[model samples]
Target: MARPTTLLACCKLYISESRNDAALRAIEQAARGGGGGAVVVNRFTDDAYNRVGYTLVAPLTPSPAPPPLRHAVLGMVRAALEAIDFGAHAGTHPRLGAVDHICFHPLAHASLRHVADLAGAVAADIGDELQVPTFLYGAAHREGRTLASIRRQLGYFKPNSSGDQWRGAPETDALPVAPDAGPERPPRSKGVVVVGATSWVDNYNVPVHTGDVEAARRIARAVSERGGGLPSVQAMGLAHGGGVVEVACNLLDPARVGAEQVQGMVERLAAGEGLSVGKGYFTDFSQDKIVDLYFRSAANTEG
Candidate 1:
């Protein structure tokens, strides 16, 4: 297979928790060896949420454009489901499954349509073979729905456990929204997965020096587009397992309102509550850095 001159695209797999080192290793090993002609470019693990984000890059050339981005993700998801149990999970981050969210992004040469089809195929395979319920969003859906809209229907924003945290699988066996693929009822051990394809999105988080989650939530709302803050910005305030709270944000349109804007807004909001703010950081690498990592990892694998 010939490598494309430009990095093709990336699929980000979000796992629920990282406490199980063996499970984490199994998933990472599967991703690295998935042989989908893809490379694992970055791995970001958050201890507070116990969530792990793995980004895999593929080549744009080579007729099929390396359909293995799906292959790689499928293997990782299988390993995750086999090793982890949603019923035994507890985290500050809201998640519905052992293998939670799967989002595909076009990096350099790949188009949204291409990754959308790929995401659909992966969702189908996961549903049919793995028997895991899957929901489609972004370009993966015929209507180009948003993930937040679907999550809202599933009651994902409410914390099922104490202290504004999510614990175990969802309480009900039935899902509010019928899955685009898979069985009607979500399994207790596996739960349901959300899969989608969209253009690049930035995952940025700003930490506040206080442990007051309510104050953080207020700041988060005031800084989010839904709350009439910046446009294309979604914010959530949550306890980060320390004497800290984070205003976790998804910058849907970073070019228009990026981290700088978010950081400034968070700082201003924290000041009102007499809370100090820490520097905000991104959970993943930049496109150029990811491409460089892909080249390096692909070469190592080829060698």
Candidate 2:
């Protein structure tokens, strides 16, 4: 809906999964109306749907009183082998569910117990729905459910990773055997990893051209904070060891110089020099999502 059905008097923040054209405007208007903006996902399309994963946003809505209310988040990530099995079997985005290795970050003020509670709820539900056993990791753990340990117990294999080579072994030892689902039958689901909130950060690197001080300075100046370039962008020029120059920048807002846009800029800057641009982007938005404008204007009253 163009106009929100409910108008909150106090500032508010919430995540919307679907693609919304007015999200940016909505955030701005809401903030102006006393509601703060949220950590929203920005997406781009590649001629198809490439649903990678979701991002965790902290502190949805700021509390009116003193300190802001800590954002209570709940999410479930797929196991590596399990995700690969589904993806390859499903032929979705290249699998290997381990997007990045397990690195549990402790929430600022919460405990593993709290996260375990959420995971427990999800596991129980998955157990019922998929008729699959579940494992719980960290503090809010179950009697037999433990992460990484659970996979180790299950003898999870990455057939695709090793070219159909069975790398792990089934739990021949019953103690290490995976627990059952609701009924405790054959294990189906690769246990869940309950995550706790923490201070999250977004960082990236954009490789630059040869070590031409002037050219490097030009690109950096054209793409930095003090240059009125990208908003919240912090950039610097560094000299590479082999007499080549690089442009280092912190793109606080990818919305300004999106991945494609950044690549183009670098290419244009380095053109006629037979150089190439390599870039990286870390964001919480959808991959197929394309930012576009949707304007609704009232006809000229006088006309």
> Each model's C-alpha lDDT?
0.89, 0.35
Give the residue spans of candidate 1 off by over 4 A.
Answer: 1-7, 61-66
Residue-wise C-alpha lDDT for candidate 1, range 31-130, written one tens digit per residue: 8787657888788999889899988888654565437687888999999999998999998988888899999998867789878988999999899999
- Give all candidate RMSDs, comma-separated: 1.7, 14.8
lDDT of 1 at 56: 88
Q: What TM-score quantifies how close candidate 1 is to the native fold? A: 0.96
lDDT of 2 by residue, 52-113 (tens): 23322222123453111111111122222233222222211121122211222223333444
lDDT of 1 at 157: 83
Per-prediction TM-score? 0.96, 0.32
On TM-score, the candidate that comes out on top is 1
Candidate 2 is scored at a TM of: 0.32
After the best TM-score superposition of candidate 2, give how far the Cα of residue 123 lies from its true spot, in angstroms: 1.2
